[model samples]
Target: MAGSRTKGSDTLRAAQMYYLQDLTMDAIARELRVSRSTVSRLLSTARETGLVQVQIRSPMDSAPELERAIRAKYRVDVHVVPVADSVNEVEVMERVCLQAARTIGPLVDSNAIIGVAWGATISAVSRHLTRKITHGSVIVQLNGAGNTQTTGITYASEIMRRFGNAYGARVEQFPVPAFFDQAETKKLMWRERSVLRILGLQERMTMAIFGVGSVDADVPSHVYSGGYLDEVDIDSLAASAVVGDVATVFFRADGSDAGIVLNERSSGPELALLRGVRRRICVVSGESKLNGLRGALAAGLATDLILDEATARSLVESDGAAEDAVGGFLPLDTASGR
Candidate 1:
C-alpha cells in the first residue's frame, strides 16, 4: 500500500509538471524518470483533480470594472481602451488616438474654439480625425511649439492642418516655444495685442484636448523625450518629486503643482484654467504612466479620461500607495489652479 501511494504521488507530480508547468509530455517523462505514457496519464489525472484548470484572462474582461472604479473615484467620464497583453508601445498609442478621435469628433461644432496640445499622441489623434469641416469652427494650438533644441512648428503645423482640413475651420498656431526662456518674455508676449488675441481665444475654448506626460512612460512622452527639457531640467524635476504632467506642467503625486522653475517658462494653461474649460479631455496610456495619470486626476485636470485597461487597473490599485507617499487626498477645488 505504501508503494502504491508512492507511485500515485509520482503520477500526480508528473502531471503537474507536464500540464501546469507547460512542459512537453516527453520532457515531463524525462524529468520524472517515467515513460511518456505515464506522463500523459498523470496529466489526465491532474486535469480530473482540477490541478490544471486553465483560464485565459481576457484583457477586455477588466475594462468595465476599471471604468467603474475610475468614474467613481474621479467623477468623470472614463473610456478604458481594451488592449491585449502583448501590445507594443506604438499600438497602444494608436488605440488611444483612435478612441480619442471617436469621442471628440462628435463633440465639435461650428463656432467652437478647439484647443490642441502638440505631442505624439495628440498628433496621432489629429491624423485619425475624419470629421467634416463646418462653418465658424477654429482649431488653436494650446502652447508654443518650440523647444530648446529646435522649433516644433512642423509638428504643430501638421496637427493644425489636419484638424483644419477635417473641420473646414481656421487654424490658429501659438508660434512660440513650449516654454519661454524667461517669465518676463511670457509676460511681454501676453501684452502684445496679437498674442493677446490668440490667448483670449484659447481662454474661451469650448473644448480642449491633451495627453499626459509620464516621467518614465514607455511611449515617449513629448515633454521628456521631445527635446523640450535639458539634463539639468530633468534632474530638477526628479528632485522636485514630480510624477507626471498635463500640457508640460509637472505635478506632484498628490495632484498638487510642483511649483518648479520650469513651470514659469511653460506656455500651457494652468491647471485651474484647464479645469475651467467646459470640457477637458485627457488621453494617456501605459502602466508606466499610472502615477502620472493619478496625479492628473488628483489635480482635477481631467474632466474626461481615455486610457488603456492595464493603466486603469494600476491607477485603481495605486490609491493606498499614493496616499502614503503624498500624505493626503488632493483637494477637490477645481478653481484652485495648481
Candidate 2:
C-alpha cells in the first residue's frame, strides 16, 4: 500500500509539472531522474488513476434554442424568463426580477463580496431577492446615488439593505451623487482615502449585479427619467451617439467608451473595471434596452443575463439571411466577439 501511494504521488507531481506548469516532458524526465518514456508513463498513470478529470459543462435548464443561440452569439450564460406577450410592463418586470432573484440567490455563499448597481430594475431585484443563510458576505453600492434633490441614502441604502438582509451580509452604502456637478469634484473625491477604501473593495469584488439603463424603455430607467440628466446631458449623449449606460457610464451601440466626456463626471466605475469582476449578472426588461444590452455584451460586461423571452427574441433577431436561416443565432452586430 505504501509503495503504491508513493508511486501515485510521484505521478501526480510529474503530471502537475508537465501539464499545469507547462514543463517539457524532457524537463520532467530530467527532474524525476527517469527516462523520457518513463515520464510519459507516469503522466499517463495520473490520468488512468483518475488524478486528472475533465468536465464538459452540460447546458443549463433554459430555453433550448434561445439559450443555445445566445450562448453561441454572445458567449453569455443566459436565463430566459418566458412571459405572455400581453403581460403588462409591471408584471413583466416582476417576472424578470423573480428569475434574477432565483438565479443570483444561490450564488450567495461564504466570503462573497457583491457589487450592486442601483436603478428601477435593481430596486425590483431587491424586492424579489430570496433570503439565505450566509456569513461574511457583503453587498456594496457600485455607484453613488445622490441626486440634487436628495442625499441618496433613503433610496440606495434601502436597496443595499434588502440585499444585505437577504444574504445575511454586511452592506456598504456609497454616499455621493449619481453624477457629480463637476468632473473636478469627482476627481477630488476619488483622491480621499476614505473614498479609496470603497474603491479598493470594488477591486476585490467577486460578483456584480446590475441593470442596463436605457432612455427608450417604456418602463423608464430611473436615472434617465429621475432628473439625473439635464438638457445638456441629453444633448451630449445625442451628439456623441450614446445609446445607454451601465452604472451611469454611457456607451454607444458599438460599445465604445472613448471620448464620451460625460463619463468623467459619472460616478460609476469604468467598463474595464466592471469587466474585471468574475461574474457580472445583468437584469434587463425592455426591448428599448436592446441597444444598451448589445453594447453591454459588446463590451464584455455580463457573464450571466436574466431577461424576458420577448426581449431575448428581439435581441437574437438580425437582418442577415444567414442569421435568419440559423434562427437568429448570428453574433450581435454590437458584440465585441464570441
Candidate 3:
C-alpha cells in the first residue's frame, strides 16, 4: 500500500509540473533526480489514473472550414460543435447545448440582463450550464409559455431556475399566453403595466439566448408540440408559408414575417427589439432544423450561432447550392449589425 501511494504521488506531481507548471520532461526528471524516460512514464501513469486531462479546442471549436464558410456567408459568428454524422438528433442537441452552455459564460458580465427563450434546445442547454456568478444579473424569459392545455409556468420556470442557480442571478417570468385569441387582446395586454414591465426588461437585455423553432424537426419544437398552436393556427402558418420562429414570432422562408398574420398576437418580443440586444446567441442542432435555421439566419435573428457539425455542414452545402441556383447569395438585413 505504501509503495502504491508513493507511486501515485510521484505521478500526480509529474503531471502538475508538466501540464500545470509547463515544465519540460527534462526539468521534471532533473528536479525529481530521475531519468527523462521515468518522467515520461509518470506522466503516462497520471493520464491512465485520471490525474491529468487534456482537451484540444480549435479556434472554431472543431469545424474551422464550416464555421468560416458560414461566418463569411452569413456575416455572423459561428461555432460548429463537433458531432459524428451517425449520431441521433437528440444526441446532437445534447452536444450542441453543452458547448453553448460553456460558450455563453464568457459573453456575460456584471449587471447583464439576459433574455432567455424557453424551448427544447434552450431547456437542454439550461441543464448543462457551468456556474458563472455575476452581480445584479437578471435572466428574463423572452416569451410567454401559457397555452390552453397548461399554464407552462412549471416547465418554463424549471428552465429559468437552472439559469438562475448557475449564475446566482434573479429570474423573471413572463405571465401571458403564447398567443392571444385576438390581436386586439394582445394590444390591450401590452398596455398593462405588468406586461409592459416584462417588455421593458426585454428592451434592456444585453444578451439574448434562443433557438429556431421548426415543426418538421425530428424532435419537434416545444411551441409546435406544446399545445401553444391549434390546428387552425398551424394551418394558418402553413398557408402563410411560415418556415420557423425565434421567440415565438414566426417567419417565412425568405425571413419575412409581414404577412404571417400571427405576428400581431405573439407574446414574444419583436424582431426589431431582439436585434437591439448587443449579443444574440442562437443555438441549434440536427439537420431537421436546416430550413428553419436558414430562415432565422436570413431574418438576421442571430449575431452568434452555435450548432452541431452535421447541421453546420448541411447549412454550408445548402447555401452553396442556393447560391449556385440564384447566381449569388442574397444579402440579408443583418439587423443586429453582425
Candidate 4:
C-alpha cells in the first residue's frame, strides 16, 4: 500500500511541475517513470484542483485597442509608458523622462556629436542618465540656450556637464537666445564666424534628442516656465493656432508651420534639417500634450517617441492624433479637417 501511495504522490508532483513550472510533459513523464498519457491526466487533475493557473502580461493590457491603433497609424517606434491611476502630471513626465534617458544612454557612441534641445523634460532626462563613461563623446546644445529673461545657457550647461561627466567627453554650449527678437537679427547672427562654427557641427550630429512643448500641456511647459517666451509670443502662438513645438519651432495641430512667426527666429534646426540627422528622439508626457505629440509625428520631427502610457493611448485612439503628413505611416491629407 505504501509503495502504491508513494508512486501516486510522485505522479501528482510531476504533474505540478509540468503544468505549474511549464516543464515539458515528456520530460515529466520520463522523470516520473510514467506514460505520456498518465502525465497528461495528472496535469489535468492539477489544473482542476487549482494547483496550476496560467496568465499572460502584456504592456498594452491597459489599452490594447489604443496600442493597435497607434501601431497601425504611425508605424514608427513608439514607447507608451504606463501610468498609475493616482499619478500626477509631474510623475508622468518623470517616468517618461527616465525611460527616454535609459533608452538613449546605451545608444551613445564614442566621438559622436549628440544634439540636445533645452527644456524641463530634457532636463529631467539628463538627471536620470546613469551610464558609465565608455566613449569619447560630445554633447552639443542644438539651439541657442539663452532667452529674454535669463541666459538659458546655465540650464543647458548643467545638462551638458552631467552628460560629459558620465562619458568623459567635451561639452559645447550654444550661448544664443532661444529666439531672436526679429528674423533679420537671427539671419545676421547666423553669419557670425563663431555661430557658423557651431552650426557646422550640428550638421554632423549623430543623434538628436528633443522634447515637445504643448501650449496647454498639463505640466508647465519649459518654454513658458523657463521664460523663453513672453506674453506677446505666447499670445501670438495662440492666435496662430499653434499646438506644439520641437526646439521652439511651432507647428499646428496637423504639424504644419502655417502661421507661426517664431519659427523663423528659432535657433534650432528646421524640420527638414532635423530629418537629415540619423536619429531624432522626442520625449513627451501629459495627456494634454496628445495633440502636440501628434503634431511632432506629423511633421516628421521624431523618429522615436517616448511618452507616458496614458498619453500614448490617447494618441492611438484619436484619429486626429496621427494625421497623414510628410510621408511615413502618417500621411499628409491637408484637405481633411483635423
Tens-digit lDDT track of model 3 for 115-196: 9999999999999886656799999999999989999999999999999998888999997988999999999999999988
- Model 4 Cα displacement at 85 (Å)? 2.3
Of models 1 and 3, which has the larger lDDT? 3
State the lDDT at 49 in candidate 3. Answer: 33
Q: In model 1, what lDDT does residue 69 have?
A: 73
Rank all candidate structures by their lDDT, best first, as comma-separated numbers: 3, 2, 1, 4
On lDDT, the stronger of 1 and 4 is 1
Tens digits of per-residue lDDT for model 1, 49-102: 334444345764887788887787788899888887799978988987777777
lDDT of each: 0.79, 0.84, 0.87, 0.76
| lDDT, candidate 1, at 165 | 88
Clashes of each: 3, 1, 0, 8
Give the Å shift of residue 312 in candidate 2.
0.4
lDDT per residue as tens, model 2, 37-105: 988898876654335533233365235677677778788999888777899888999989977887787
User: Which 10 consecutive residues of model 2 have the lowest summed lDDT?
Assistant: 49-58
Question: What ranges in model 4 sit over 4 Å off?
Answer: 1-60, 63-68, 320-338
Q: Which of 3 and 4 is the better model by lDDT? A: 3
Residue-wise C-alpha lDDT for candidate 4, range 1-338, written one tens digit per residue: 32365644764687667656788889877777778888888776544333343334586476445556666665556666777758988888888887777677656778888888878899898888764454667888888868767887677889878777766778888889888989999999999999998898888888899998887877877787777888888888888888888877888877788557888899978777787888888898888888788778777777777787778766755665324442334344442122
Clashes of 3: 0
Candidate topping lDDT: 3
The TM-score of candidate 2 is 0.78
